[model samples]
Target: QRATNVGYTALRASMSAAEWLTSEKSVEITVATTTLDGEGQGADCALKIHRLKQPAKAQRASLTGYQPYPVRRGRRVADEAPKPDPANPNSWELGEVVAQDGFNTDAAGKATRTYQLPPGPYRALLTTQDRFGKEVTALLPLTVLDPKGKTLPLKVPNLVAAPKWSLEPGEDFVALWGTGYDEGRAFIEIEHRGKLVQAFWTEPGATQQTVRQTVTEAMRGGFTVRTTMVRENRAYLTARQVGVPWSNKQLSVAWEHFVSKLEPGQKETWTAVVTGPDAKKAVTEMVAALYDKSLDAYLPHYWTGGFGVFRYDSSSLTSQFENVVKQLRHLHGNWFTDYRDAHMVYRSFPEEIMANLWGYQYFGGYPDGKAHGLLPGMAGPPGKDGAAGPRGDKGEVHDMEARVGGERSSMRAMEAPAATAATVAPVTPAQTPDLSQVSARKNLNETAFFFPHLVSDAEGKVKLEFTMPEALTQWKFLGFAHDRDLRAGLLTGDVVTAKDLMVQPNPPRFLREGDVLEFTVKVTNQSATAQKGTVRLT
Candidate 1:
């Protein structure tokens, strides 16, 4: 690039050195003039040109991905990954400072040079040339919140917490929490100045419970002391757990019949019935789940039998599995996809015929056929010497007389049933009318204070002055089913898909990016009556 005009006389030009100066490159954004239609109404349009900087648009990918690539930056185009700029931090972003055709008059009285400002809040004096000719200084704030919303106070302990402690924003001084306060739940109201703000001590959707209240939005930046004294009449401890008994029944009947007609043939057909008054409801729930906003995306990659992630062996075996194989045969041109987790239920079950009537292992003679799991008749917890139980009276010689056949089998002596019968064990028969009740109870381990997300300190002590009507069984979960949020497909990561079946019109999408992340909390009940008749559907 050459300068067009140098303001020097022709006589002095010969005296001037070959190069008087090397012009420093400085970016400037000047508004352009555009005539409005035929009206000759001119409007201002600006072009910003500067040394090409890093990419302005940033994006993130989830853990589950078809192909994973980090985001960066570039001069000509946006790179995959762009780190937060400590110097010109995205602490705040006010959109891109776009560049286009632009012009400006230079120092020697001649128009030259393009213009661009590193994407901006349009704050003045960002780009500056140092002696080294490099980007010298950039001061910018991070753009944390995207889209329009009130600035929510920073949550307690942060959003990535095990037990997310958050505050709800509302008018007035109310500062409300979305976590537990007491066992059942409790809330406190503080009179801030002359305004009423609630200090609630409860978690919403906690065990399917929602307690809403108004609270103080701001605090005095100091700790407020609180004290409460209470007395109660009781002995041991009483923690009430209300569990509804609901049956989920999936019934299938399949039979093979040989025809006596001219052509001797075999025929097999199956009828599956999901029964009970709640069957359709359950079907609706599952069908809804297939396409449910939280889960629809990941149904295809689901692993059956309660496992995480997709194993290559499963992908291989799924093709030959009875369900996939039979579906291919039965449906002919159309085939069922093995991705649905329920295919584990719909597929051909383990057949006892695989074992002969004598119950012999069928694959013992087959090469490369490894028998899986435990044998049908294996007993006593895999490997233990102990038998079922002991015999009360066994070969005893009492008073020096060995009486043969002295004992007779009683009616309760019959063989135990091969199948298990469900039994209900009550913690307490009933709360006693008469029990020692006292005030200022010093008790630890309150059920109301339990939080799965929060662990109580082993050294901490809590006081409760209450008596129990009966012995209470302490509970700490082990091998328990995962909460429904994960199992029901609310966690629709990269591999989730809606192809299995859909609960139409319900689409679950995870925020690929943004603020104010939210998820649904589904509270299922056996029937409307199960939850005080507040439940609209079973």
Candidate 2:
């Protein structure tokens, strides 16, 4: 039995060694040596070694791209590796190499290289060899911008005039006029709350251009006017309209009948209707002007008289004024008495307009002569009558009538109600919800998957089986492998496991028995074909 056991153990050991030699993914190297003893007897010594399996051939280079930084003209800018083409993510486009450098990695296998490149688009290509003698390449794209960066030469509009700062949406017209530079066409852009709301292009010229835009609800919060001089489809100059609060409000004026032509010594009555939420409380003003051909300007009708403007309080919504054309001649001589074209302008403002006026005066006026201030308050409709109050005491009412009749009244003492003991109910403390069973549905927050000792099969492939965590997210995988010979390689990738049709319920963390909640659930369909399903909540 002992002999048999020894033979069985030896045979099993030999079989295991043979399987290792044939099944293992490695190469065997053997060295044999012959030695001679003093007595001339020959002996043989054998050594066996294993080498790393042959590395796979270099199929294609793996490129790691980087985001390109904006390069400014006249400045030295560094380049980055080229990014993959959007059309073909596996390939990269080649470009001219304006700069180049060589670097050596440190103990951490990391290196940095700097290059000064000129302003233009560029691509950086890097090639490296792996431990297996396989060559891989990394590509990155680079871009250099002009020295101005996002800023262009500022070319302000010679004039940005609107008929009124406050306007009615869809009912009022806003006229904007601007002067453009000689080199390009004026591109007008209207932005409201940092968003472009309207934009248009003007005729190419170094002349004044005008556009009439109807106000819309989108412009109620005010807007900014930006003018850019575009030459050859490139913006060379740009500016924003400043010193004005271009907003809509609740105070406006409309002419009932405008009197544009007035003869000498003729008295004409001009009437305007004030309309808006605060029309009844707004202040209206009018100014008459006569155009002078010699000065090429319009002179105020009453330039030599009081204030040169008519003021009215439109408490009833209508403002009217009568002016005698001859009075202008009497005050300022024949220059105003000439047969010139006349014009009338009317404007209305809420109570807050005084504050804006004060600010304008305090700041000595703006360079653009446009007033800037807070929006005028919008007065709502008159409130409805409140409910009637309880009837007054009889004696108090009688005394009020006696006083109205001019008769002396006698004071009467009123009886007070009897006091009664108050009854109170005992208060009960709120009971905490039973949470012992609330945790029945276990929460799996541990999303990490680490297989430190994974063994690949003979074909150099690994199969992993696991139950994914209940979290909806992306998982990144990093793996490295090394053979007995110390030849190593690394790889990284991402995996996402999700249902084509999924229903995710977003419930509150905790809840009471009778609590009302707006339970919401997100349904996502990621399959190529559209599908419909019903959902029921228990």
Model 2 stretches astray by more than 4 angstroms: 1-445, 508-515
Q: In candidate 2, where is summed lDDT lowest over 10 consecutive residues?
A: 10-19
Lowest-lDDT window of 10 residues in candidate 1?
A: 11-20
- What's the TM-score of every candidate structure? 0.14, 0.19
Q: Write the per-residue lDDT of candidate 1 for residues 151-233, one digit (tens) a residue.
A: 21121111111111222233222122221112223233333333433344334323112223333323322112111111121
Best by TM-score: 2
Shift of residue 322 alpha carbon in model 2, Å:
98
Per-residue error for 373 in candidate 1, Å, reads 83
Count clashing residue pairs per candidate: 49, 8
Our tally of clashes for model 2 stands at: 8
Q: Summarize candidate 2's per-residue lDDT along 1-538 as a digit string, tens digits.
A: 3222222111110001111111112212211111111111111211111121211211212133334455544675546454443323123344344444444333333343444444333445554443343443444443322222221111232334443555556655444343323334566776555656678776544344555556666555445566654333233333333222222232333445443332222333433343334333233222222222222234412122122122221112222222212323355535545576678777867756565455333223234432233223322112234332222242111224546445221222134343332112232334333334332223334343555565544434443334444444444444444444222334443444455666677976655454444555777887899664444445
